[model samples]
Target: MSRLAGRRSAVDIVIGVVTHVTHHELFHDAARTLSGVDLEWVSYDHEDEIRDKVAEFLSTTRLDGFLAGPVPYTASQELLPPGLPVGVIRSSALDLTLALYRAQERGWGRTPVSIDTFPAEAVEAVATALDLDQDQIDCLPYAPSQSVDEIVAFHRDAFARFGERSYVISVRAAVRGQLSGQIPIMSGMPVPATIRTELHELALRIESDRASAQRFAAGVFLISDAPDEERARIALMNHLHNTPEFAGAWIENRGRRGVVVFAHKALFERITRNWVAVPALAEAAAALGARISAGFGVGVSARNCVLLAEQAAARAELAVEPCAYLFEDSGVVIGPMGPVGAALRYSYRSHGDDVERLAKYVGLSATTVSRLAALDQELQGRTLSPGELAGHLGITDQSGRRLIRTLDAGGLVSVEGTAQHHPKGRPTRLYRLRIAQALEAQPWSSPAATSSS
Candidate 1:
């Protein structure tokens, strides 16, 4: 049992593991070593049953984290709920090494072996460590599009070429089943150590997320141009008091025109549906017949939280229509939170002429370029596929593809690689936006150029 299991105050973490029936016992034995975790197994015997099984698991269980092998993850990626912590278990080099040792024990030498699903680098490293010839090894790295037949064919060809000397090592159970009778094969199942490490990491992530969600948050609601200040304030308070979502919140009046609320950050997130929309602001406006602006702040101290809320409320007041804004201690500003298309988020810091220059150079509007800049900052150097970018920008996939081409032409983005979220389609190209770098590279106006202008 882990230290977490010994803690009486520790909340039970439920983990859902999706895998083939063949590996159910293997995963169950591994999960037993994790004392505080409740493992819910969703096992499928065939590829076609994976999606329904995953959906059923999600609907039936409350999962703090999810785990699956690469094949199952790829098959059911689209079915998972957004923002859920997911861990994809890959066959480690250690697992591959064990499989090779097993083959050796069966009187098949490590040389002249065909392996599938393990990376080529891993194969080379193991073969080099074992003093095996690289030329005698045939490796087929895992691809999301790779089929069982293709793997079987690759191994069969290697065995045919190498005659009696060659054997196969496969990470996929289907491939082993396909080639079971005709060829010598070894299964490269992930060992318990690898599974345990992934589970521990996933549990830590879930705990961290829970802690962050429970942080203190403040919301300030202000009514502008109200005919009766006290009545409007009272009305706002009443509406919030009647709201089912705000039932747990602490609500009070801030000033003649403002109402304040205090609650866990998670409550606010639920009310706003994870910052996508705030229907309460719209509802308040319609009910009170006044222009209402709301600001939410999350900070280290209560005083700082209220100050930040006031600052965000001031920003909301400048907008032409009623809206809401969220200001965080980390300096992220998300708002004008109306409908989906109207909301925009960015850092509070000034962008100056760099955004304008980039926009003009790229033949896009300044606002679009600014949003892209904010998105680049939010990503923190992680690459995104066009489909994922579309989700972020609230646009169609085709539009995202077109925008990627435009950015590629303008030197604002570079293709990193391809990511196959699903098994059937072509892999989506991933790109990292270089908006900040592009802005820095723009030439400054010289004195002579200024004088000429």
Candidate 2:
């Protein structure tokens, strides 16, 4: 039964089924038939051809995801594209039971056996079901680099130990071929239910991808003028058009002001998948000599999204570097999208009145106070040295010390520790920002005013 059958306009999810042989091809066809999902089978004779075959399928077909049938899990992982979700059909308990039942017909049940398949866990599960221990069966689990000769040797050794009573169960057809005449080799292939389960998993992943793409997130990019600014705009448009995998048709040309719409999913996926992706994108842009300010926004409507994106763009423009900013729906503003954004969001909860009072008391701007609070959060509420405060404020140590004195006097910060300076100099005191406490203190009183009086 199709999970999507009752929908108003049901989309037939296109999937690529990759397998090695004709038998597995039939198995996958049955799987697709049972699944009630569209499947395109791409078979390769040799394991090495899996990469090329999968590439061909992706280029020709609109595949939602891939099902690696009878394909080694390790090989499938190596062959398929990094972005595509891959599900593998491997030996299950049913496979082991069915193979054993078949062997029982040939008077081989309860006999000592050797098996070669993917993962030892599968064999162990089957063994547990039959109330047998690991020592009773000789099992050689397949890894990516294991050779056919090694498999043959393992089977030969098992046969030597148990003689005629020894039976061989192999998942690989190649192993079956080599040991056909010598042992009662039964195929321990994945059951129909396992195949269906994997296909269902693939369907879920595709649905998730579609839903994520449909989510409304806006990006307003500030593309700095090139020598031929129009040419640069054209170049960017062409670049977007050429890469449908990333940009798709989800881009709008706003001329020299650049595109108001850049796909946030692309950037979001990149960031989620790789921690260094934000920095990586910046470095890539730098290498291309592209001075771009990208701001991402997500909201209910296009108007709100654009406004939020504009705010994000304004934030991005503050830094002298090329970066991306995200305007989240929760009113949390973050980014320069790399290292700066990594620590920028903490304490940016924006208590404007509170920040203003603290800034006045500390003889600092609201912006400086906000930055200090954010830094305090990054420091995990630890006391900060004057040098650290100076770096955060982009000021000299003397200026930082003077500001700290004002804040200390105003009760916005309290001295936590002191480090004695060399020889004759005064001690350097460390202070922790008490912005939350200052915020609660109600009316602002200027430490600068109090000192003068």
Identify the leading candidate in terms of TM-score: 1
TM-score of each: 0.70, 0.53
Cα lDDT of model 2 by residue, 354-417, tens digit:
5644454333444456666666667776888777788876777855765564455345676676
Q: How high a TM-score does candidate 1 get?
A: 0.70
Best by lDDT: 1
Q: Show the colliding residue pairs in model 1.
A: none
Residue 154's lDDT in candidate 2: 92
